[model samples]
Target: MAITIKHHIPGRVRFSLAVLKQYRDLEDWIKQSLIAIQGIKQVRVNSHAGSIAIEYDAQILTEETIKQRVAALDFEQGEAKETEHQYTRGDVAMNAIGTLAAVLLPSRWGAMTTATLIAPTLIEGVNELKDKRLSVEVLDAIAVGLSAWRGDYSTAMMTQSLISFGEYMEQRTSRNSDQLLAELMQPAETMVWKLNDNQSVQVHSSSLIEGDLIELKPGDAIPIDGTIIKGAALINQSALTGENVPVRREEDAVIYSGTSVHEGNILVRVDKVGSEATTAKIAQLIYDSLSSKSEIQQVTQDMANRRVKITLGIGAAVFALTQDVNRLASVFLVDYSCALKLSTPVTFKSIMYRAAQNGILLKGGSAIEKLGQIDTCVFDKTGTLTYGDMQVTDVVPLDGTNDARGLLAIAASVEEHSNHPLSQAIVNAAQDNQLPHIAHGEVEYIIAHGLKSTLNQHCLNMGSRHFLEEHENVDFSPFEAEIKALEQQGRHLIFIAHQKRLIGMIGLRDQLREDVVDTLSQLRASGIKQLIMISGDSQYKAQMLGDELALDKVYAQATPESKSRIIEQLKQAGHKVMFVGDGVNDAPALTQADVGIAMQNGTELARQAADVVLLKDQLYAVAEARTLANIAMKLINSNIKLTEYINSGIMLAAALGWLTPATSALLHNGTTIGILARSLAAKHAK
Candidate 1:
């Protein structure tokens, strides 16, 4: 094999198109061989790119030798493109052929054929023993060897065939998860419209470069991160923000990749291209998450490794005490290693898939387990508990008319065309109540205050209490107590006056999420003993909200760093804290908590820092996620328990001479299948 040297620097060489069709696993074989040569530091193979990058000590090995080693790599190809997951078509076909021959041939011929077929398994087992390790492969080889020694070649062949198939199934299940993520995040190939000299031209997205002016119409995905140069539109940023609503974007407003234009058209100047885009960074984060071990995964692997030595020791003792080959083989065949190793990863991936379907993105199995263990849950006030938008809560008429609805109608008409959240809330409320549109004369917006308009040639003034009392000089001494009561309830008031006299006051407040109270009650009922609310709002407002929601603790006017400190204090007090937030300011606190759950409408930084994301944008999803975690962990424990108990029972039966090598093998394989089926069938229980 010849390789093209793509680039060379001191102590490094990169080879392009380094893979061969006949030996897809050639890269691994090359890496294993080359790294053994005295000076190599690291070997990285990107099978997708068909390239290899190697770093070595220049002093110990010359560049020419490295190149020659890669080119002169010669060995019989045993398998095609071996990976942590490479049970290829060739391996499957070989197993099928071996099993057919063993089943159809005479005893002597079948024994010989089965022995030849299991040659690789035996060789791998020998290698494992030489390296001082007890592998499932070793146990499997022992079982097959014992059966063949007894002239039961058909049983040996069937056991070995089933073992290979089982391994292939486990590898396939694990790899499917990685593949699903890749597919979901994979970039689509399409043509983008570029604007040059105010003319539109279509070009492939790959051809798009930085600073290119691109035209986007409704329903087109934004291809680059940039500011809008012309036009205006509503952008659906669900892919980035995880929110379902379409946000309005005007000229000079920034837009990002993976977000789609919902309405109108715009010309945007690209600021970042390809992998530099924010969405690409998110994809990279997801890929990086796959390599990280969660606490449970780490503990499970460690326990399995320890169990291997114990199982091997017990098998040896059983053989010594029994002096029966079939009984000894049974002891070797049934063990906890296979079920422990395979079930954990498979269950984790199953939960991840289920979470995705429910609009929650759990980064890994570790997050799921941690979520289940959380005993204290902390929530951010604004945009987390409340809707983050103001809504009209009350209307009081004081101008002797006592018609609150008419006053509200007047206010809604005056602010109908405004873009402010407060104004939008008022309009939305009026529409919800089926209020008719009231026509008015040319409207005037007073900066930092209110609006002015004329209905039937009479002046209408609507604004703040300060704007009405000081600016318009309206007397409200009779209603001072009423005003004070609303203020104490954390209400925001907008005063409306007609012909320079007070007519009414519109009271608005941040509405809490419809299911927030129920969700909090559920969390408390689920053993989360401490429910705390942290916010940057004023102490008075925070207290009002706390009393309303019946929270156990409240921290008002807290900064991002202060929130982090609070989380630390909670941890020091022996609480496993889970923080729920949806802002950039909450990123630090989110990272500080034992588990960070970000809302769907949260900023990119917050979502990236969070271990779990509520893609459905509902707070109740938090409780649902926690419930799912509990179910998954319970299932894992059940699988481990059932496997150990069943294996123990079979070992006892074999010791009593009630089971032969063939029957023991059948029982062992059947138990493994049963455990896996139960783990896979696990689903979220309410």
Candidate 2:
């Protein structure tokens, strides 16, 4: 297994800077490497002047290829003589200054080099978008600019621009913050493993770190990775593991350093320090997640455009009213979207992490956003809704064989080790009947089909209708009508046979979820327009379940891809849809929907793919989220209205000579805080 990098898919670019061994030595080499690809397998890695860079096409050059090429370089073999360049502090600062100069131009004015300097910065400070006072795009630009500004100031190149000592200090601090996050985001370290036939790992950590024997108090950051030497506590690791509530950790429970201690205090032995800590990776993921685009990217894009126009229009109107461009420029400092933008993604991620604590995994922000807009939910039933658990309900013997149990018994013995939930159920059912299970049979596993196995030298097979037909044995046309009658009532038919002889048929009924009917009704009552059921079960059983749940639409016998297609179909027809599923089988549909929701106890894949994960598997969680969203949007709209009313009224007063430009500037900035506070009121509403 190799991880495929999907960096060049239009809107995305993947870039990395090398982690220099003697990082302090070569700043210029790092800067030069930034312009091109940095070859790999480097051990005694020396840095460039300041940063390492990669060419755009490097994504196409897989890591494996680079590893091969870098291995061949043999840096020490040639007594390797290569020219090393040197630069003074002023030279480095001047070069960086030149780069930032070109990058200052707006998106429409720059070239590729400008993008290299600015793009990463834009990605870094994307959270500023939450400041509604500014446009999302303007925020992005400012973020990029701030980074460039910091870089220039750090190298002492910003002296020309900073007219005062105060400005220089501000520029320096901003640079420090930028560099801090960048240094902390070094690529994840990989570990090699050796295992015997047993699946368990002998030891987990590779190295040990010594720290002051500090007792971790409740609500404290772990500070180091360690095994539980003493004590226990419920750890609320929303910051690290994304769990809403704290998870309980007892003695002998290994606690990763950096995850917070939510409640109880404990003694832990430090295992790893610094970068190797789990908290570091969590922080990196948080940063990357903020940088990446969510599903409703339109909100940010539109906000960005609106800010630019609002600023332009406001600047003119303010100039006419107060006759002071300087005061007008001060209005530009208010970014009202900061709280809104940053909180949305952060809140969504927190929800995902909470879901993980409840045993669900939602892939990313995009999926979470999609889950919020859902109206019509589509589901893949067998594994998703139904527990995918099966049990033999009936045994129908055919072809004059009075021994149907014998064949089922033989088949179940061989399939005991199969991973399918259904197979496990069958084996358990056979054992319950005290049926003799003969082992030592060769079994063949088939995808999308039933398995074939030899029992006591007699060929036996079991699976779906198509698989049975392929074997050309077990011709059950005579009993087909009876089977259809049974299936109409929600019974599943599994054919068991021995080469050309129909031995018996096993009927299984997957138990319905205890709360499914109530869940569906609650969602519909919450204003969900359509409840569509997607299942691989027979049409008869599918319709039966739909009727039981009062679902408006039902798609029976669908594959995973088909579930996603159904979601797209509803969206195309102009309805917002939310899909609720509980297993990996529903991952595709979860990703495809407007809002994908998972039950509290859903599979990791389904949870990760969903936008909102239901904490308790109750449909009410969906209702809670819908109501929350409704209120959030309302607050957002109200904030805008208040801002507009205040600005327009203030401008009128300024124009009539009642207010000075300086006074207008102060009031305009002051009212922003008040408006935001009033907007926050809706956050607590029902």
RMSD of each: 12.4, 16.8
**Tens digits of lDDT, candidate 1, 122-202:** 777787789887777677677777777778777787777767766766655544555444433334444677887865677
lDDT, model 2: 0.52
Which window of ten consecutive residues has the lowest lDDT sum in model 2? Answer: 155-164
Please write out the lDDT profile of model 2 over residues 1-686, one tens digit for every residue.
12233333322333323433234443332222221222221112234422222232333345444333333322222222232223234443543564465547443333444444445335433543555444533543552353334342221112111212222222233223223223322222222111224221223223324542335543344545667766787764444455544689988787764355545556666665543344333333434443456644446445635655665565567667777634344443333343233333433434444333443334445654554456776655664566656777877776665576766676677566444566767888888888986664556655345677775577878777767876445677777787787787688777777775667777888877676776666666656777788887778788998887777888987766778888888889999877777654566687777778776545443444566655454444555555455444444455555655666676556545565433544455456445544433332333
Q: For model 1, what is the C-alpha lDDT against the true structure?
A: 0.74
Top-lDDT candidate index: 1
